[model samples]
Target: MSRIRIGAGRVTAEIDEQGAELCSLRYGTEGQPGATELLWQAERAWPWHAPLLFPVIGRMNGDRLRHDGTYYAMPKHGFARDRRFTVARHDATTAVLALRDDAASRRLFPFPFRLTVGYAVEGSRLTVSYSVHNPGPGTLPASLGVHPGFRWPLPGATDKRGHTVLFERPEPAPVRRVEDVLLLPERHPTPVRGRTLRLDGALFTDGAVILEALNSSSLIYSAPGSPRMTLSWHGFQQLALWSPPEADLLCLEPWYGLPSPIGSDGEYAASPGQFHLAAGRSRTFGFGVEVSPAR
Candidate 1:
């Protein structure tokens, strides 16, 4: 069993095998403070933290796809935090877990890779590192990212229904698109309101704000004046805003790739945010969230 103890306010969670084939994560025996650490929340209260999508949301729906004659099926989101993994190492403020692509993974994901997820706590910020190893030839395509959901009611979100997810930039970028599949973005960013910006369920009329190149790299979610936390997505190329119709939590995602829209090319070839790793070569992707002090 692997246990994660949060450093800040004191919260813990235990990850172990359960009756269901899906792994299970549970919080500490005693109650926790604030909201449990990012991963701890999923282990305890939110066992299902959005799956089948790569870095972004909405899985492509096929295990394998024939892209330009190549076949590959990504297991919803790239297999990482879900599959049965062993604790590579641990400490009071940091831990590392690793998972191998076995017969099960090979059948669905047709790629040989090793995923190592580590959490390092530094004061109110945690820097996560992902080291992926590609052991196959013929080039392999993959995506990576951070899907951390903050406990809402965030002091004072909004009288309105949707969350006022704000970015640190004054003007939007000129390199994004608002297509249907959620893949490669076109240029020209949109305003922060209306159907295009509605915070309701997956009713994504107000296409996501693709911050391809904004002045700052951090985005904060809060009421208006009262600030909750400003998540700094370091090394992250894109930010995705999503939430359930009436759910109390909001997810601020920093992604490496968004799935191509329906009827689009599943093959990462010529795709933005698409990554290809050569055999024996290693690749890394990372993003962090900084929990700021309350004013």
Candidate 2:
């Protein structure tokens, strides 16, 4: 997989052609003093830096999509993360990669669609944008998401347990969980107290904490003595926070869909949290991350 490097001011990003995944994001230039990497280096515990989720956000029932009375085997998070994208445009601080449905994609998704991902860096912020277009004659049922993992301890932080996620608004609503990769029907009390959620490994013993009723479009991930990062999104309806047990990374995910509910019939069109795109129409979603210096 080829990689493209883009930078502006103090931020730099490297994106891979395969999936157009962001492989690295740094806060300062190489060989400069106090340079820090904000993204997790795909270590032994997790093999992905950042993965783009398309067509579907999470696992489908029985890992199959039932459409028009036919079942197609679809992998968890769909196949966009594994497909090679064409570099549609590239410059010093911005790049766009595109993927159109081919014979291989149609076999799994059965839709004539085009997906494009764009990345741009300005100062200490990086913005990732997604666009999905339906070229087929029928409505396209799809979901999209981004899973980016940052360093657990973060730069300049002494302890990972001191990290916290501060939402822009109070999040007292209950959150959902996953079992066997399927969404559980029951809702659990949110761990957030007021607007803050303290980091803990035990919180992810089961799976990601799904915030289906998100009230805030932005949040700050911070730790004492460490640089803080603010994440803001638009056009996404849900959020998830996940980390592998004992791993040195934390993934902040913004999703437009949820996994198939337990005991679901695996129907594609009837699934929860999916947006239908009319023929020849397109929809766009985006999120931005801005890093601030530690106090």
Q: List the residue pairs that clash in candidate 2.
A: none
Residue-wise C-alpha lDDT for candidate 2, range 97-176, written one tens digit per residue: 99999999989999889999999999999999999999979999999999999999998887687999999999999999
Evaluate model 2: give its lDDT.
0.92
Best-fitting candidate, measured by TM-score? 2
**What is candidate 2's CA lDDT for residue 88?**
95
Each prediction's whole-model lDDT (CA) = 0.53, 0.92
The number of the candidate with the highest lDDT is 2
RMSD of 1: 5.6
Number of clashes recorded per candidate: 12, 0
